[model samples]
Target: MFSNTPISANHFLIKQLPQATAFIDKNFKVVFVSDKWVEEFNLSTRDIINEHIQDLVGISSKQWENNILRCFKGKRTENFQENYTSIDRETRWLKWNILPWYNENESVIGAIVQAEDITAQISKEQKLEQVQFILKETNEIGKIGHWKYNQSQDIFSSCPMINNLLEIEEDSKLTLDEYIEFYKIGYNRNTLSMAIFSAMENKQSWNEKLEVLTAKGNQRWVNVSGKPLYCNGKYIGIIGIVQDITDYVIKEHQTKSNEHLLKTLINNIPLHIYIKDTQSKKLLANRSELDHCGISNEADIIGKDDFDIYDKELAQKYRDEDLEVMISQTPMINKELSQENSDGTTNYFLSSKIPLKGPNGETTGLVGITMDISDIKQKEKDLRNLIKVSSEQNKKLLNFAHIISHNLRSHSANFSMLLEFLIEEKEEAERQKIFGMLTDSSNNLMETLHTLNDIVTINSESTTNKKEVYLNKQVHKTLKHLNPLLEENNATVITAIPLGTSLQVIPSYLDNMLIQIISNSIKYKKPNVRPEIKLSLSYVQNYTVLSIEDNGIGLDMKKYGEKLFGMYKTFHEHNDAKGLGLYIVKNQIEAMNGKINAQSQVNVGTTINLYFNEEN
Candidate 1:
């Protein structure tokens, strides 16, 4: 890829600049990348040209993507310093600018990016922000000036500009002793001497921004640079420039303070902000996140992770996402996580996590922010359920209409036939048989009406006042209530509902569903087989599961299972099998936000599984 191309010679003045730079087409395909860009990223021209920039380099945040998009639109963005992890996995604070490159026709062709690593400078500034701010505000007095200090004479003097900047006498013959006193003690005195000495000894240039006490006893912040001056190749003096840069210093101070202000703001905000050190896996969480974990605001989170305070499953999930962010060195934005609420509901949050980098372009840690989107997610969930409920109700309504019309018509026809037989029959026995048939038809119609009424009642009331319905207690109550019927059938009931299996459901509805299911097992037992039923309860994910198994004369599931929960559908030859028990059980389950299913095989056994929403 680097084969004999004019650009391969590194024959551009832009290559001579210290900054790392590269140019890429609208497709993010590299066209011309400077040597410094290749060197800084530790890449070769063969690896860069025609390769997607992001594939060969590392950057985080959509802001970088937005900048590139803007450049594609022929706009220019400049001077935003951010810490980035390079392709070589080193972290550096880069100050960068991206501009649209123009073609011969003056149309935008591609984007040119330039960046300088300013990690060392920013790191030093941060460590000394407070002290530097104090010194600058208290002691800044000079403007741009020039001065000379003779090493042999141990003398210091300056022009009018320097004297004015220091607010001193222009003709004052300042000796090295007098000049030394002008530098405030500590860093100012020590640092200034070191810079000057280093410059003189090495015959090189040196610069420092420091504070000084003037001849008039007023303090000042100054930018001073010294160059070794030689006479016939022997060092004689140092020539220097002195400029008051107090305005720029104050601005820099404010800019640094904004970071602290940002931290304070984040702590107070409702959104949860979390940061974790990758090496230690220790979290630094804001007040909202701390509060979520039931921790006091004053408690330190520096050595803790999600696993330290959250549920194991939830913590594991979060830990995985944290690793994903750190590994990709990318932002995972607007991801959803749902947590159970104390009130037996669910609350969802949208979170974003991105890798945080250190000064040397290393992925040191990651930061994330999560905002509660419970209201929105709840609305979405409700909408989905409503749509499902609406469709189900529509189908049920059509089925109801068809069944009611056909069954009522059949009963009416039976009434007419029985009345006609009673009126026309000459024999008393035939009239008696017609009367019995009429009574049976009337009872059947009433049973269907009762089942329809139950369904209608359940469908009308959409709200449920749910509480913690303990499974073991409810199951025992159901079994105890039907003990007499079980005794008649010589049924043996076995239960293995371990402690603490509970659900969020309406008290009556929970009892009704269990009773209907458990009673069915006993009611439909195999003859001479000594009926045995097993009831087991457990918790999985966020649901409480209750399963009932019965060894009985099971029906052809393929023919009957589809309509097992439908109104007035029965497969067994039992006097009480109006087919409404399973229907009522299904409705009760759904009323409490639960689900039901059955599995059966002829002459073997049947198992019914019910899942209820567990209380959180």
Candidate 2:
């Protein structure tokens, strides 16, 4: 230090600097240190002056030592930033400058070393670098970019991410007009233009989602956000960020379209479909379901429980079923539900319900589908009735066969016996008696044959071979033929049949039936009471009904109702009662696909109704 007296004088000046600095002599020993240098390095209790520079601050690098050695040869050396560690093992950043000091003879005497502690500044720079790295990574991964607009200069600048998104060259400078051209032509361009204008005029901030046409002629969706830049009450420019949102936009559009399609499909289906949440609240209902409930719009039913729409008891039943299905997480498929209406009719439904589950397989709600099966149920009932009727007809036909065989055998035996007797007679009187008996037997056989023939004809008649017969004309014709019998019995016939009242039937069969019915009214009249018969026509559901009321010897219905229409069944003991008229009439009516029922009281009257199918 004595070799450079001038340097010694300036050492005090060097120590007065505000920076944490140090001065060293050519021998690599620290000669002076500033107050800030002691505080910065935590060397207040240590005497570093005159200490070897390497001892105080370890400079282990060879290049750093060479630079310090060069200062002794009248050369200057500097390092703006270098790493260092103090003797206490404290790491720091330093700015170093080493220069030669001259004596009075203008020759190099020793070196001066100056150093500044730059650890805090270096730390701030490192932190800033790390932030920039993170931001760049985020922008690339998100397909996003930042942009700036200079309004006065009409300049637009964007980051590298924007260039990649647009599929254009990197670092391209664009004019305001050129920048806007990247937006799509119709809605996107117009919107961006207005946004820019508003931002420039009113200094407003805006964010918009818009479409862009890339340089490669591809379409993309993007979201742009902008904030007006202001400086000291003066509007200057705009800063904004843009993000590529093509994937998100496409997915959103597809989702909406699918929702619309599903809604349309469910609405058009004939079955009633509905969705309910765990709370049994209606979440969705299709058109059929809405129609069933007499609702015009599905929105009116949303978030409403069954209790809000249906009868209290019915709603409770539905809710209970729904809860059971959801709680069990099971599906009820093709379950037949029958409801008894107030009118004593039962309505049927084919219903299905499935549990709706969450992502973790927990029950969330249920979806139900129901179809009205009342028509099908009615058809089943009709089929069962037809089967029963067919079975009964089969049984009656069997009985008829047995009756025919028995009657034919009896007639044949009587004929053989009478002929045998006639051949063995030896007297004329006996021959005459045999002849009379033969005649009577022949007549009886003929009558039985005719009756059998009639039965066979009625059963074998073709149901399709039917013609429209006016009831009034037919009744009149039958009465005209029976006028003699009617006069003898003093029987009166009254008719209230309409002129055009008609029934589809076999004409010959209908004529025979009318004759039999009118004759019975006359023959079975009470011994002292003149017979009175009334004929009328009326219409009932799906049937044209003809009713005949007779004031005659009526039988007790409770005793004979079941056998009234049976073959060879007779309630009266008249000599003319062959027990076949009502049976034949019933068969003929059935052959025409009509029905007959009778109501009667002993010694009072009888009313017989014939139902003819209107459709037939």
In angstroms, the error of model 2 at 594 is: 3.7
Candidate 2 local lDDT, residue 8: 60
Q: Model 1, range 381-475, lDDT digits (tens) per residue?
A: 89999999889878878987897788889889989888988888999888888888989999988976777787778756454577876777888
Residue 373 Cα positional deviation in candidate 1, in Å, after optimal superposition: 14
The residue ranges of model 1 lying beyond 4 angstroms of the native Cα positions read: 1-385, 420-429
For each of the candidates, the C-alpha root-mean-square deviation to the true structure, in angstroms, is 30.1, 9.2
Candidate 1 matches the true fold with a TM-score of 0.38
| lDDT on C-alpha atoms for all candidate structures | 0.80, 0.84
Please give the lDDT score at residue 558 for candidate 1.
96
Report the error of model 2 at residue 428, Å. Answer: 38
The local lDDT score (0 to 100) that residue 319 gets in candidate 1 is 88
* Model 1 Cα shift for residue 424 (angstroms): 4.7
